[model samples]
Target: MQNLDILTEDHYVLSAHIFEPRQNNRRILLINSATGVKQQIYFSFAQFFAEKGFTVITYDYRGIGLSKPNKMRGFPASMRIWGTKDYKALTSYIKTNFPGYHKFCLGHSVGALILGMNKDSEMFDEFIFVGTQNAFVGNLKLRTKIEAYLGFGIVQPLSTKLLGYFPASWFGLGESLPSGSAFDWRTLILNKKSTNKLLEKSDDFSRNLTQKVFVIRAEDDLWLTEKGVLSLLHNTYPDLKPTYRLIKTSESEKNEIGHINFFRSYNKKLWKIIFTRLEEGSHNVED
Candidate 1:
């Protein structure tokens, strides 16, 4: 694994890591992490793909992990910037470095939502969505909906106001995030249009994507819901062909593949499901 810094068009430096394969299959994978989630969470997953002859790249978005500013307070970063600039920069780096390789992107949670902001999303041959959805409160379960209302509607805003950033880790959501990024997260849950509401600020390409998307959701992920997942497909990315798979908790050896645990090394066996879809997608499955 080699660490690198990629500069976005706005001149912001993003911390990234590339896992090189000993044997090349000419296939490349770019992993976009969930909101406030660190790139290190994907190291094992990236290494596994690398051993399988697929070069994998993982990076932290601005105001996240290694890419964060010296102080969380007043940091200037948001999800919109993540897609419009940071994600775009990564794709540009991949295109310039691995021109002939078959490219695939694996987006986790908010990682998938940002696709609409950047036209470079079209460059990938296929996409893999893990634990992602519109995440509107109306699309969630009653219990989760209440929590969403309380947390995002009240707690998040209050904390962000006091700290100049959202302490996401305090809620077990992930790491702390810039205030703008935190507000965008709140917008996703509170806004009826969900992802489309966020896209209004940028060039909308959510419907332009026509690639096959492997959509994977964990059954026990309390924050995820079927209604939200379907809404994301039909509303935000209607043009993309989707093959859905509901991963039962029993499928996990530890019986735990929550929103984040799906990528954990303990769940390595489940990774094959992704490999099969990218390696050879002959099945149009909705499990």
Candidate 2:
């Protein structure tokens, strides 16, 4: 694995790590991290794909992980910037540095949500979305809805307003989030129309995106309910018609592969399924 700095067109420097395969397979995989999550969490998965003959790259979004600004308290970072600017930079880097490699993206949660925002999304050959959802609180499960209400409706506003940013780490909700990102998430969950507005550009991109998309969701994911995922796909990619799979707990020893556990080393069987499916490249419905 090689660690390097990626300079974006907007001038923000992002920290990234690359895993090169022993033999080039003419394919490259870019793993995008979920909201508030660092790229290092996907290291094992990057190495796994690398071992499978894929050149993989993982990087931290600005204001998060290694790419965080010197002054994080009032950093001007938002979800839109993450999708539009950060992802654009990463894709540009891939295209300029590794020409001729078939590009594939594996995104988790907000990572997948941002793909539609990329103007160059059509360049990718395939996409794998895990735990991606619309994030509307009402569409979530009862318990999750309650949690979302508290987090987005109450906690996020109060925290961001008081501290100039969201202290998510202090609340055990992953890393701290910038004020803009926290408010953006709050708006999406609190108002259904917010998601619609956010996805307008992505919807247009999806309508013309010919490449296949594979969506994977676990039954026990508290953060993303089945209804939420379906609504998200329908709204964002009404014309793309992506394939999907809902993994049952019985499929794994843990008996519950929630939002983030699917990539853990213990879930090797699940990984194998994903690898096989990617190799196949054909769409099949699986409920």
Candidate 3:
């Protein structure tokens, strides 16, 4: 494992880690984290792939985890910047140092939504969408929709306004986020265009991607739904070819695979679904 600092084109430094495979398989996997989630959350998952001879890497977006600044207030980081600058920097590094390798990117939640913001996304041979969706309120379940209205519609904006940042941890939303990041997140739920609204504000390459994408949805992920997942694929990434897999709790060792826990060490066995799919697309790894 190697830890290093990568500087974005805008001169901001991002914290990153790389896990080298024991036997070089010429395959690389980049795990992009969800909103307010740290890269450390993917360490075990990355190591699992590394052990299987896939060079795996992880990094935190700005204002989250190691890439965060000492002061949270007024930090200028939005999800758009995550893809355009932070993610692009990582791709630049991989393309330059690991040329000729088959690159695969696993996008968790917001990680998947940001793909449209960067052109580097085109280089990946395939993409893995985990616990991600369009997240428009209209696509959510009844319970989740009401929660979204009360939270993102009221609490999120008020809290972000008061603190100049969002103290997301108070609500079990992981680390605190920069004010801009918080607002951008609200756009996903409250805006009629959902992710497309954010994409319009920045560079959009969603339609350009036609690679096969393996989509995984945890049955117990309250924030995810078939409607939401299909919305993302049809509305935001219309050009991509997606194969869906719905994982039931019974498949997990602990009978739990929520929005983030599928990548948890306890559910390591579930990683095989991804491995099998990537190894041979025709292997019928669908769950």
Clashing residue pairs for model 1: none
lDDT of every model, 2 decimals: 0.93, 0.82, 0.93
User: Residue 192 in model 1: shift from native, Å?
Assistant: 0.4
Q: lDDT tens string, model 3, 1-287?
A: 99989999999999999999879888889999999999999999999989988999999999999999999999999998998999999999999999988889999999999899989999998999999999999989999899999999999999999999999999999999999999999999989799999999998999999989999999999999999899999999998999999999999999999999998999999999999888874233222
The residue pairs that clash in candidate 3, if any, are: none
RMSD of 2: 3.2
For 1-287, candidate 2 gives per-residue lDDT tens digits of 99988888789999999999998777888988988888888898889988998899999988899998877788998887888888889999998999977788888988877777787788887889898888888788888788888888887898799988889898767788889888877877887855566666343354556667788999888888777888877876665548889998888777868888887877767887777876776223211
In model 1, how large is the Cα lDDT of residue 269?
99
Relative to the true structure, candidate 3 reaches a TM of 0.97
lDDT of each residue in 92-119, candidate 1, tens digit only: 9998999977889999999999998988
C-alpha RMSD for every candidate: 2.7, 3.2, 2.5
Worst 10 residues of 3 by lDDT: 278-287
lDDT of 1: 0.93
Error of 3 at 95 (Å): 0.9
Error of 2 at 68 (Å): 1.1
